[model samples]
Structures are given as structure tokens and as C-alpha cells.
Target: MTQTLDITDRTRLRRSHERGHFDRETINAILDAQPMCSVGYVIDMKPYVTPTLQWREGNHVYWHGSSASRALRNSRDAEVCLTVSILDGFVMARSGMHHSVNSRSVMLFGRAFKVEDPAEKHAKLARFVNGLFPGRYEGLREEHAQDLKATTLLGMEIAEGSAKIRTGPPKDEEADYELPIWAGVIPVTTTVGTPEPDPRNLPGVEMPEHIRKFRL
Candidate 1:
């Protein structure tokens, strides 16, 4: 894959162009750091966006949903936009207009394709689970054929996208910096909390290392 993504009208940043990045390294890093994403697609000339979990492997990104989902059905072989964002901090400036967010976000545009082969779909699902919680899939019950049939996996190559990131203190006007009001960043982070075990878990079934060590 090329080191940088091709810049097209759709991928160009019209505002705050300084924050735009086209390198694959920056794009992949942001995608891997966040699993939750929103997918935008059109149906019958109406637009819709669905929130879902995403996983990346090599130069491709994948997301899954119910086979009966209207979004997944219409997204197949259709142009779609996938976006992932991570909020790092809230920028507080002297003026309300200067207040902003410190964040990293990526927007990708492509034609989504369905994973038609059952075996390939199954493997991809396992990879998705194992990617988040290593070795956890092996301890769980095997997936039923019906379960796999009810799930739909869609993927797109990471060929047309750009990442926008903002960090550090807010940018305020030179005159505003002298104002008496304090200005700084309030850091934000996503943290994993303690895991709660199922009430019905069998006796002597201990929490696996993968679960204990899992991080987002």
C-alpha cells in the first residue's frame, strides 16, 4: 500500500486544513485505537447512519451487523462513509467561540462489499473477537450455523480517507490571551472498568487472563 492516501474532493478538508493528514500510518493508528464507529449510507435517496464496532486488518476495515438490518442490506456494493473518532480533551479558551475539542478522527469513503463465503465470514468474526480479547473466543461455545447465517460482515479497503487530529491548548487570539479568565485543557479518556462475571457461571470457572488484561 502507498504511504499516503490519494486526496480527492471527497477526502479533502475544506476547513482547518492544517489538521488534515493523509499518511496511512496516522490513519491506521486512529482506526486501531477506536473500535466504535458510525457508518453512513443512503437508502431510497434518504440518508442513514448506524453506529457499530469496527476492526482493521492490513489495509482493510470491517464491520458487522444483523443480516436483517436495513443499513447492512443497502450498504452492500454501495458507496458509504465510515468514521471513527476519539476525544482526547476539551479545550477551554477565554472566549466561548474559541472553545473546542482536542480529538483525532478519520473519515473513509468507499463501496462496501459483503463477505459472501460462510467460512471467510466465520473466520473474520473470530478475528474481530480475538482482536479485542485475545484467546477469549476459544473458551466460548462454538458458533451455531444459524448464528453465522444471521450475521452480515462488510468490509472496505482503506484506500480513500484522511485523518484529522487536534491536540494541545486551545488557539486564542493574541489579545484574548491577556484576559483574566483562565484557559486550559480538560483531559478526557476512555477507561475500562472492572469486569462483572455472569451470575450463572459454573463453579471453579475463573476469569481468564485475556479478560483481565483487556484494554481499549
Candidate 2:
């Protein structure tokens, strides 16, 4: 049996309940597929949202940024919202009101904390790089002390979250479906192109397999 989350008032699905999911597997799948996430945090009574790259490990989600960022600094001990999404297709409907999009998204609520451990933070950073490009971390040199110190890593538990997904064609009014209008879905996806090496090169170095076949 799939484990389900307790639906609190804030996390409950008020409408289109069928499209809502609280299962761990569903939530994890969406998070794992997307590397970019928007994090919302409040600083000194002012609201702010910042976009950054993120990675997941177990029930925790981690993101990093320059240590100098005010939002990242304030988020160290504050409750925040993190969201990730992917657009699968566009749903065309006979009526404009019914036009929609097919997408999968996850929303998480938790208090983020700065990762203070040097060794742990280093490993987390490595995971972020290797997650996108397999075996590439081994090719890079060790992180400099100053560089590592300049980076700030934050982590939050996926204790409270929800996933909202929509797929297939648009749902139009019953009478509108019979009208003379073409309706279907236009599929969308993220693709990788050929890798371009840096202009300054020491010798002939071929592109790595991970770079040649990168996909999300």
C-alpha cells in the first residue's frame, strides 16, 4: 500500500481533489525530476522569493547559494516554502475558460537551516554536481577552502508537502466539445543540445558521455 500524508487545512485540496497527491513516491518523483526550485522566505517582515538549483536526499531537500545573499542568510532559521515543477504539455480546449496545462509540481513547507559542517556541506555540493553530470565530479579538482567558505548550503525536511498534477486533454463544458474547434495537447519537454567546449583549450579533449546525452 502506498503511504499517504495527513491532509491539513493548508495542504488539503479544495478543488479538483483528484489531481492532488500526498504520497511520498509521487512527491519524491516530481522533486527528483526538476533541479531548479523557487524558494520563498520572509526577511524582516518582507516577503522574498529566490530561484536556485536544488537536490534531494531521503526526506530532505537542499539548496545552495552565495553566502552573501540576504535571503539565504535569513532562511537559515526561518520557515520557508520551496516549489518545483515541470510542464508536460499544453491543453487546448473548445472554450477559453477550460484551457489549461499539463504539469507536475511539488510544494514543501519547512524551516531551513544552514549546513555548518564543512565536510557534510562539501559532500552535498558534490552530489548536486554529479546528479546532473554523472562521473564529472571525479574529473574536477578539489574545492578550495575560500570557495567552500563562500558558499552557503541550506537544508529543509520534507515533513509537510503536497503534489498537484494535471495530465491528458483539457476538460471542456459538455456542450462546447461538439463545437467546430480542434482540441488536443501540444507536448513539451526539455532537451539537451551538443556541448560546446571553451574557446581556450590546451589540447584535443573529447566530450564526456554525460555531456553528450544529458536529459532531464
Candidate 3:
């Protein structure tokens, strides 16, 4: 069963109500599928949107950057909107008005906070690397104290958000459907390619299971 989420005032869908999904499962699926997101916030009433990679742990989403990053610095303790999106295909319609792209997207509102504790931040950092490749973090070089100190991690609770999705063929007006036009979905997909080994890798190092089977 698809569970529904209680829509807060900020998450309420205004236009395409039917396409709005507040369910946690649906929203998380979209987030997990995409590794990057854009965070929108304000600095002295000036708006800014930044592109950064994000990861999900349980119900919270986190992102990290250099300690000196202005975007990350201003984002801490600030009300922000985070969004993730995937382009599935292009929908060609008989008319330009109905032409659109099939996509899945999520918008979240929250006040982001910096992960202050070193131990907590370190654990989250490990999770960040492990989330993409299962055991790669343990096999890589150890993080130094200075390295940890130079990076800052920020997290936001997934308490309020909404997912809007569009799929399938384009919807055209009844009259426009009979026109001599070709309309269909030109599918788009993201796939992992063959692994390219580094020339400096140690002799006879075997590719791990995680890397061999990664998708998206």
C-alpha cells in the first residue's frame, strides 16, 4: 500500500494536485535515485541556489563541502529549500504547449544545521562514501584530523517535503491528437559504464563486488 503524508502548508500542492506525492516511500525513492541536489537559500535577502551532491541516511538528508564554502557557510542554521530531480524522458506532443519531459522531483523546506561533533561528523562522512559503494570507505586511505577539520557537513531533517512527478506519453487536446504529428516518449537513462582502473593501483587488485554491479 502507498502511504500518504500529511501535507504541511509549505508542502501543499497548488496546481497539479493529482501529481503531488507526499508519501515518504515515493519521496525517498526519488532522492535515493539521484546523487545531486540544488539547495536554495537567502543571504541578506539575496537569493542563491547551489548545486551539490546529497545523501540520505534514514530520514535525514545531508550534504558537505569545504569549510570555507560561502554557500555551505551561509546555509547553516538558515531556512532553505532543497530539491532533487531526475529526467526520465522527453515527451513529444502534437503541439508545443503540451510538450514536456517526464521527470521526478522533490522539494524540501527546513533549517539546516552544521554537524558540530567530530565523532558524529566523521561517522556521517563514512556513510557518505559508503552510501555509493558499499565497502569502499574501509578500503580507502584513512581520513586525517586536518582533513576532517577542513570539511563541514550539514544536515536537515526530512520532516517536511513534497514530490511532484510526471510520466507516460504527452497529453494532447482531443482535436490536436488527429493532426499529422509523431508523438512519443524518447526514453532517457543513466547507466554505469565499465570501470576504468587507475594506472597507479597496486598490482593484482581485484575489482570489488560493489563496483562491478553499480547502477545509476
Please say which candidate is ahead in TM-score: 1 or 2.
1
Per-model clash counts, in order, read 0, 0, 0
Displacement of the residue 132 alpha carbon in candidate 2, Å: 1.2
Worst 10 residues of 2 by lDDT: 1-10
Q: Candidate 1 lDDT, tens digit per residue, 1-216?
A: 112232435626333233445367788999999999999999989989999999999989999999999989999999999999899989999999989888888888889999989999988998999999997778789999999999999999887777777888878989999889999999999999999999999999998988899899
Cα lDDT tens digits for candidate 2, 1-216: 112232435536333234445366787998999998999999778889999988998989999999999879989989998989889889899988988778888888899988989999989988888889988888888899988899999999877777777887778889997899999899899877778898885577778888888888
Model 3, span 153-203: residue lDDT tens: 999987777776788888899999899999988989887799998999889
Deviating ranges (above 4 Å) for candidate 1: 1-22
As a whole number from 0 to 100, the lDDT of residue 160 in candidate 1 is 77
* Model 1 weakest lDDT span, ten residues long: 1-10
Most TM-score-accurate candidate: 1
lDDT against the true structure, per candidate, is 0.86, 0.83, 0.85
Alpha-carbon TM-score of each model against the true structure? 0.91, 0.90, 0.89
Q: Model 2: which residue pairs collide?
A: none
RMSD of each: 4.6, 4.2, 3.9
Which candidate has the top score in lDDT?
1
Give, for candidate 3, the lowest lDDT window spanning 10 residues: 1-10
